[model samples]
Target chain A: MADITQLEAFVTQVRRDIVRQVHKVNSGHPGGSLGCAEFLVALYQHVLQRKEGFNMDGNQEDIFFLSNGHISPVFYSVLARSGYFPVEELNTFRLLNSRLQGHPTTHEGLPGIRIASGSLGQGISVAIGAAAAKKLNNDNHIVYALCGDGELQEGQNWEAIMYGSGNKVDNLIVAVDLNGQQIDGSTDTVLPLGDVKGKFEAFGWDVVTIEQGNDIQAILEGMESAKTKTGQGKPICVLLQTVMGNGVDFMMHTHAWHGKAPNDEQLASALAQNPETLGDY
Target chain B: MKTYIDTGKKDTRSGFGAGLTELGKTNENVVALCADLTGSLKMDAFKANHPERFFQVGIAEANMMGMAAGLTIGGKIPFTGTFANFSTGRVYDQIRQSIAYSGKNVKICASHAGVTLGEDGATHQILEDLGLMKMLPGMTVINTCDYNQTKAATIAIADYDGPVYLRFGRPKVANFTPENGSFTIGKAVELQEGTDVTIIATGHLVWEALEACKTLQEKGISAGVINIHTIKPLDAAAILKSVAITGCVVTAEEHNYLGGLGESVSRILAENHPVPQEFVATQDTFGESGTPDQLMEKYGLNAAAIVKAATKVVARK
Candidate 1:
């Protein structure tokens, strides 16, 4: 596993890339992307056992699925940094005919993405399916799914949660990016996701909460604990409490930055918080 | 009109059950998933035999669809069974992202499609499923008629890669197609050959089309009849050839005319060979509770309706 300093540097670089890439396009969901940066870095660096040059049928390595696909900026940055595709492709986000679609998809033969997931609430089910497949094939590889807390409002997510827990999808781990903010407003003001931990627990899943979703050490610790919970005859859910748009000072604590890219001045100020660890795309 | 010997009508879902059970014996990779509709979808046989492989999702169709998609990742061919309504509309996004967009090798088996679903009414009877499924990219939409063809389609989808939607029905219809006949995806099978008019039909209405052909033949109006089992990636060559000879077309299906087999056939004919066409189908309306025969009559999906449609099309020609 990488050291905390290295992981922090990697995460900072990823955040810069996400903000810069979104700023370049002037279109994308940055709030969740920024909020979940530390968790994303920890996942690629320490949690999942993945290899370079993407393989769709991953047998020996852990598989990951981004259920709430709006956070493609974070996902794209992590995948590129992890060597799934060229980092230069990050500049082509949402461009016409570009493999880096507005949402992550396998249609363009994007290296790391095995499924199109802009449509929320479907990823958990796909992850369950992949995990189930791993078991059937005796691969022993676990499937990890990351979904936004707001995305759980989608009926499909509930269906997936119920099915996974009821059927004993022991090889799956579902993580909720609980930023508590959505496009319209805060989750409480929009539609209160009353007791997400309790909700998942009631659904028969073994639920855990990461107190500091924006802290790399905390995120890593939470994920390691999640790994230990796998293959225990129950699907596990981690409720990650995070602030929307964590890195940028002005963007934090507001839903306005949920999908808005920072202007030139805002971008400059945001980039100032974190130095360029790796070169920007 | 010629009447085939009575071997007793059988529900197409039964064919699906038989085919899935047989497929399990042949392919160890074959697995089944149901959203609390095992009996309704006739997946009981597969569930009984392949207990480990069969998954009862318990009223969660979306999850059932997703798990099916995931099952395909490990080289396992997952067949998800449910009513047409829940299969297409209720879980459209799930299928769109996980299966269709991802290009997963999952088979979505939907039974009790169209008005023939009877007492369940419009909620269960999905007339728009054909249109909904055919519009998706890389989705092979198949609406099989009769017991043999449904069985054959179920067995065949396992060999074909990528996502496929197999639409069957609850009502029993003819079991006439040869048990040993090859099941091709986009090949249009000509049931009866005639030059005056071509009667194209799919699903439960193919039997009505054959009957309509017989009636037309007896009345000295040689009407051709073709069974278009596959709706998407339509057999354009066969359709154009039959249309060129007949010079007129009549399409029939147990679905709404808007995006049904009729519309697909008409679109093909209009583009390739301009011809006058009439459709025997529901006229963009929801179905009500009634017996299967009554619903077929009300929806203009009977043999007499096909005969009338053929006459009108020939008159226009």
Candidate 2:
């Protein structure tokens, strides 16, 4: 088990990396990236039983697929901090010829990323596939995927959701970042994802919810419980109720910061809130 | 002139089934996923033999494509089977992002391709699949001519790394290729040798090109036939060699003249050896409900069409 204080410090550092990377590029998705910092931190640092180092074929290790790849800022941060790559590489996020693309991809030979996902609603299906592969190999490792709530509107997600549970893809856990905000506006105004929990349940998934998704302890607990629900003949769905731009005060609770980079002054303010816990990249 | 024999008539999908069944027995890592077309795609044997390795994705081609891409992360070679239309157009973005862009080893096995899919009409018969797949960077686009070649290609793609689009058809065509032939990717097979004109074709059109070659030989045209199974990473060398000797070429395929095998050959020739060329392909039109032969004849994708194009191109030369 990871120490609570150490995990909290890691979450704070990830938040700093998210803001810094997006601010450095002056382009990227910071809202969702900032929102899921703690969850991703918990996942990599503690939750997932991953193998040492990185290989393209994650044969016996726990694999994660980021369906909402716009959140590459936080994902790259967590992956780097987890020793998948050098922490300094986070500085190259979305830069020309950088391994850290605008969206997470295995194309550039990025260590942690398994699939390319930016065009939404593809990750859950891919996770189901990896889980199925694990079952075939008798590896018995769980596959995890994170998706956006707004991304659920893509019809492919429903198809994948139905297939996952219908086919008893029980060795997978899909987490939906239910921040309730998209690029345009709140999900309610854009396209209401009515009762996301009910929707997953209707699709035959075992649904769980983390009321405080940004809280490191809560995320760790929820993920631990979600892990226990695995291998029960139904895929798991975790509705992570996070605030958009979670750690930063002004950026939180709004869709304005969804894909926009924070200005110079705003970056300083965002950095102030996060603090230099593990040193800036 | 070289001669060939027709072993029998069989649908290329059956060949896919046979290959997949063979893979199930031989390779434990080879997994199959079908979008509710197990019987149509002829994946039933594999499904029955290795129930655990087969995934019935139930009418969701996009999700199936995503899953196939994901499966590759764990070193599992995934073969996604579906109709040509649903396989390419319906899930093109899924394949582009998840499989091709990510450089995953996924075999996208598409059956019931071209107008010869027959009664299904234009909605199901995808004439642009070859073009759609070939345009993607690093995607290996293959259109097998007969049952034997289709089966051999299916098994061959498992060993070959990276993304592949293997197109076959539903109707019983002339199964002339060797039963256990060595299927090489990006290498054109020369069926006949001549100097008057080169007849290059793919998929069902390969048989038509061969038949046209026989007709041309009767007329003292002495045409050469080359079966170009792989369209992308095209055998430019083989095409150049054939066109260098023949001085003119006629490209045939069950696809549109634009962006199909015809255009690919034209580009190769224009860059290296500019030759008088004629296309024996659909002229940018969708097909309607009809028998396989009727559709082939109406679309000018038959041997007679190839002969007409060959004669015209030879005259131009």
Candidate 3:
């Protein structure tokens, strides 16, 4: 386990990266990005067993996919900070000709992205395919993916959820960032996702709930437990309960900042709450 | 004129099955995924022979497409199979985002294309598939002429590393191409030579084009036939060379003239060397239940239509 103080510092740095990257463009999903910062930070910095460099062929190593690709801010930040690319490149978050597209894609030859996402309900099936490939290649590594709770409304996710369990794809884990907020409104208002835990359990997944999805320690512990449940004849689902716009005081508890960037005044205030432990990009 | 004979008849879907069966023994990285139309798609042999490498996605084509895209990350060449409609229209966005945009090396093998799917009618027949597949930037779109050509093309796409849409039909068309012939991605086949008019065709219409050439020959009009298997990276050089000699052209296929091979050919001619071109295809109409022969005749997608188009186009020239 990573020291709580050091991990907490890394989480603070990731939050800073998310806000500044989105604030520079004035167009991005800071809510989910901020919400997913701790889970991604814990996964990349501590949990995943990946190789030194990135390659499309993920043989002999674990791989990750982001189903909710609108949260590219956090993903790109964690990837760059984790040594996939230079931290300075985070400045070109959604600029023209930058490797960072509005959604995560490999078309621009981005180093860490394996599949093009932002089209919801796709990443889980991609993860299952990678997991099946790993089994075929005799590689003993796991495949992980993250999806938003609102994304579950797409019928294709239900199709994939059924396949993952029916095929006995045991070397896989899919986590839902249950922030309960989407573009229109909260998930309940937009389209109620009732009994997600029950839905996944009925689909035959081994379920675990991280009640404190924004807390670094809780996320780390929940994910680690989820990992142990793998390779035992079923796919795992982690219901990570997070706040929409987690770190910023003004941004939290509302769905307004889901895809809206912060203004100059709001940026300074958001940064003040999470002081930069590491220098800014 | 070059004379041709039908050795026998075979459905193009069986050709795909045969080619997949061959890949099973040769390439270890090759994997197959079917969306519960295993019998209709003729994928029984590949599934029987290589059970471990085959994935039965069970009537879920969207999931099959996503899984195929993901399987490519671990160096697996995944071939996804289903009807033409389900393969192209129903799961288009999934293919666009996950496979086409990402540039995954997958083979979207589609069967039962066009009116020749016969008794199933419009819901199963997909006339706009070629247009949909070709519009994507990096996608290679292929519509095979016969069983032998479809088989050869299926085996060839595996060695080539990119996304490909190999479209074929259900009817037992002429088994005329060489059984062991080599298939090239963007090259066109010149079936016969002529100077009055050129007849270009794809899928089940190549045989009709050949027959049209014979009918035009009797009327003292020499008709040339170019079998265009790959429609996206079209054999533009061959089309240009043929049109320069023939001076007029007729494009035919088992698809809608609006977005099918005819439009693609028209674009080529209109840009470089515009000619008096004719389209021997369905005039923006859906197909209905009938036998393959009756449907082809009713839809005006056979030799008689091709000959009429050729004669008229030649007169305009």
Candidate 4:
């Protein structure tokens, strides 16, 4: 295993990248990006059993899908920092003619992306399909997908959720970013997602809850347990209860910053809180 | 006029089934998915033959479309099957984002298209699927005329990499094309030579156009027939060549004239060789419950309709 301190440093760097990239464009979803920095960092830097280099057909290796692609800042930061592409390309996030689309897509031939998401709730179905393909190809690698809790309201998610467990899609893990917040207001005030874990369990999934979702150690440990639950004739669900904006003090525990980027002074303040762990893009 | 023989009659969906069954035996990477319409889509053969490769996503077309796109990532070709309505309109966003925009190599095989679906009425019939599919960038839209052509097109698409929409119907119609004939996407088939009028048709109307050609000959008019199997990336060269000789054209289809094959041909003629054209399609309307023949007749999508349209447009020239 690598050093935890170094991984934490990478997470801080990813946070800096997220806010800085959004601040430059003056438009993006920074709250969810900051909130999921550790999860994505832990996923790319440590967890995923990735093959060397990138190809659209990710054969013989673990593949990932980002369902909540509005938080693309963190996904792009982690992917670039992990050597999927040049780190300097993060500067082009959300810019026209750039591969880093506002949401993730494979149309521009972006490496490490198998499907286009951002319409929400579709990543689960796509991941389930990939998992079945791996089974067909006799590849023992697992498939992982992440979606926002608020995205669960899309109806198509339930269609896919029912499909995954009913067909015994056991070689997959779907995580929910349970920030309890959406664009308008908190999930409870907007539309309550009652008994999220219970709903998954009733739908024939193996549920794994991570209460300390922002901590690198907690995410790693929770994901490790989720991995162990795979290949057991049931699809796995990871409920990650993270603060909306975890790292920056002012951005936390509110729904206001979900899609709003930081202003000039707010960017400086957000960057100061995270500190410069590695070099900035 | 050159007479063509109907070897037999068969539903186009069976042709899809035959092609899929052959692909299941030939290509290991080919996989099939149906949203609770395995029997209706004539996919039972492939499902039974390749149970491991076939996915039965019950009653969820949107999920099936997304899954089909995902299946392509691991070098698998997924063919999603359902009615034309469910395939195109019900799950358009799923198809647009996951398959079309993402550029996945998935074949969307839609059966029971247009008024030929009959008795099921307007809710199940989708006369605008061709328009919807062709609008997407890089999507290959194909509407097969008969059983043999549909079978060939179905097998041919497995070899062509990219997104494709293959449309066919449920009723048993005239199987006129050669058995085991060569199928080429975007290539038009000119059925006869004429000097008076050209009858360009797609889907179930090609056979009707041939019938109209015989009738027009009896009326002392020479009408040529051209089969447009592939609508998008339309065979503009063939249409122009035929229109140049005939000087007037009648476009026929089991779809609305607004954005169907008629409009595509209109754009071509309006730009290249300007000619008088008449549309033998639904005039921006919906269909209702009836026999396949009754609906085709009521919607003016049959041989009589083609004859009148051909006679009228030929007069303009």
Residue B37, model 3: lDDT of 94
- At residue B163, give the lDDT of candidate 2: 96
Model 4 error, position A159 (Å): 0.8
User: Which regions of candidate 4 deviate over 4 angstroms?
Assistant: none
Instruction: List the RMSD of every prediction in angstroms.
Output: 1.5, 1.1, 0.8, 0.9
Badly placed stretches (over 4 Å) of model 3 are: none
| Quality class of the docking in candidate 3, CAPRI style | high
Candidate 2's TM-score reads 0.99
Kindly list the per-residue Cα lDDT of model 4 for residues A1-281, writing each as its tens digit. Answer: 75789999999999999999889999989999989998998998888999989988899999999988899999989989888888899989889999999998898887877788889879999999899999999999999999999999999999999999999999999999999999999999999999999999999999999998999999999999999999999999999999998899999999999999899999999999988988997
lDDT (tens digit, per residue) of candidate 2 on A1-281: 67989999998999899989998889999999989988898899888889899887787888888999999999999999999999999989989999999998888998987889899989988888888888887888889999999999999999999998888999999999999999899999999999999989988999989999989889988998999999899999999999999989999999999999999999999988878888877
Per-residue alpha-carbon lDDT of model 1 for B1-317, expressed as tens digits? 33454367889999999999999899999999998889988888888888988988888898888889888876789999999999999988888888998899999999999999999788888899999999899999999988888999999989999899999999888788888468999888987778999989999988888888888887889987889999998999988888888999998999899998989987898788989999898999999999999999888889999999888888898
Give the C-alpha miss distance for residue B274 in model 2, angstroms: 0.5
Model 1, C-alpha of B288: deviation from truth (Å): 1.5
Displacement of the residue A246 alpha carbon in candidate 1, Å: 1.5
Lowest lDDT 10-residue stretch of candidate 2 chain A: A55-64
Alpha-carbon lDDT, every model: 0.89, 0.91, 0.93, 0.93
* C-alpha RMSD (angstroms) for model 4: 0.9
Q: On DockQ, who's better, 1 or 3?
A: 3
DockQ per model, Cα: 0.79, 0.85, 0.91, 0.85
